[model samples]
Target: MEFSLILKKINNTLSAEKELIFNDWYSQSETHRQYFKGVLEQFENNRITVDNKKGWERIDQEIRKKNSTKSYWKYAVAAAIVIAVFSLPFTFKNTPSDLPPTTTLEQQATIEIGSDKATLTLEDGSSVVLQKGEHYEAGHIKSNGEQLLYDSTKTTPNVDIAYNILTIPRGGQFFISLSDGTNVWLNSDSKLRYPVAFAENQTRMVELVYGEAYFEVSPSTKHNGSHFTVTTLNQEIDVIGTEFNIKAYKEDPIISTTLVEGKVVVKSSQTFKKLIPGQQSKLDSKTNSIEISKVDVSNEVSWKNGFFSFKNKQLEEIILVLSRWYDVDFKVQNTEAVKIPFNGVFNKKQEIENILKIIENTNEVKFEIKGKTILVE
Candidate 1:
């Protein structure tokens, strides 16, 4: 019933408690629904034709709520922005998850935001810790804290190509610019093995040893028509020049490859399917079968933009993602609770406790924190 809650719901930032409150108010009566409809219509039109100027003022105040992210004012120039809180799709107007909820460790057992950090294993088997605000250089490869950049301008004279492995720890993330100018964004608990300098006039290859990564591959035309291929356990993605995301986490049963731009062919032992933009190919590792489906590309790649976007995701699956991001463990005391579907969006800048508290307010479940482990019931 509160206008503030409605606004939060509109932006997909509704707290769990306020979500229930808004859902109740939304479903309570047709008049309430009409008022909500009128609010959105006003947002679309940028004016209020109705005489309820006082109510409209209250709505305006909610839109200007301090620290707001996706206020109606953001979509002032455009209309048709609707909140997909329950069934409608909340359009980003633009614009995944390790289940990252950034927080400080001062008062609790210590949880910090997954930062720009990774362990780089050089060709000599030596290792270097790459984190924000640090620098490292080897041969033609260099890292400037936030990203690892390879100098393609230099030529590799080594008879054997030198490979570098990057491993991202939990509560961390990193980016890499491959020797061929292919860009990769690695998620937490992910590893990528690539060459320091891609060989010329040959197929460019890399392995997603594990975890998730988003790739903006450099065009083959830049490399004299060298096709790029990404290899996983039982899958291979072939692309000439395309942008895509691959999720091959060991904990997850399915290996998902979501094509954002360009084209990719996802091949398994069973069959191969070519993916177009906005399409996702999910391979069942156990069955070795792949299923292609249309997906919301924004939801699949939202983590690249620093937000956790869930579209009717089960709590159990969501918990797994969060555990990896926060470097914590979670146990659900109530089996039934694991299947509960939830919808909302969260920024990684929030504290884990705050996020847990927000979800706890839903009353469908409660949380017990023991050290860094979370028990849900």
Candidate 2:
């Protein structure tokens, strides 16, 4: 069998399958190990542009020509396959809202919810301690797994509730369940505001003051009639019941709403667009235009799932996201560095230094962290 075919199988395998394939291939011969090393070196050196198939093809052909062996064809084909798999990060549609939007009930949104550390504030205008290793809960409110849950059924009757704001700093994360049974997962450096409970006959609503969040709204009582709406940055997502993710970070240029299930209408006070499952609606800050497109919802919501999945993301964009999560300041030495795109998925639990090391292995760039500052060279 050709090395390309072997690698194709390896790339597509899950953890256990990968382990099996690696063990089988590695035991085949010493030459197989050497070939694996060569491929690893190419990836580490950033010789492969994840989005540039042509550039990779050229490089692979050159490597084959220099080797001048009948086995060279396998290398070229394998390199192309590997490059395509890795380049998944950078592939993007021309428009943000190219994907179709959902029209069913069940609206969902994913939001970034924390910062460098998690803390809580009390109603007494005093800061309360939310130390790690401790869990807190009350009627309609519970927190576990670094997330806060809100169940509206437990609130006191016929009284306006005082809303408390929860802010998650960079490097910190949290989740929340609302009184109306809405669930939100907040990424680093985010915030959400909600009442202790909804008053009688009050509309179910929560404000995303900052950062990003993913929401899974409970079905409305009328199911066929009533609508649930979330407001942020001059935009409103109205739905009856849907699953979707919304990213409205203050620093980002556009507010992105990705629908995963049900139907949603993303409306700016002035304009509106409806989105279907597997499609996204984008609110552009500069032009103020609403763009729509089909997208892989999983990739957009990966952060909430404990992973940082980058698909054809520019080096600068990656750094920006990292800066927010790691709570570090970065200074890019060269402007052109912003144009360099790469693809990879990293677990958020990993140390910042480990990720930097992985990028440094790309050989095209190096980084040095001084105190709180990250200097990219």
Task: State TM-scores per candidate.
Answer: 0.73, 0.68
Query: What are the per-residue Cα lDDT tens digits for candidate 2 across 1-377?
Result: 33334335435643675667676877774334544553454345444443344544465567656764323433433343343334333353224243222122221122222243456554555554443567776554556536666665655455657777778877677777776777777777777776667655555667777788888887677333446778887788887787788888888889899987788888885689989888999898666689899876656776765557666677898888888787777898967756767666565655666566555533456676666677787
Model 2 global lDDT (CA atoms, 0 to 1): 0.64
**Candidate 1 ranges with C-alpha deviation above 4 Å:** 1-109, 155-159
State which candidate has the highest lDDT: 1
State how far residue 342 of model 2 sits from its true place (Å): 1.0
TM-score of 2: 0.68
Q: Candidate 1, TM-score vs. the true structure?
A: 0.73
Q: List the residue pairs that clash in candidate 1.
A: 84-88, 96-303, 98-321, 114-171
lDDT of 1 by residue, 159-267 (tens): 6688889999999999999888899999999999998887767788999999999999999888888899999998999997888999999878899999888889999
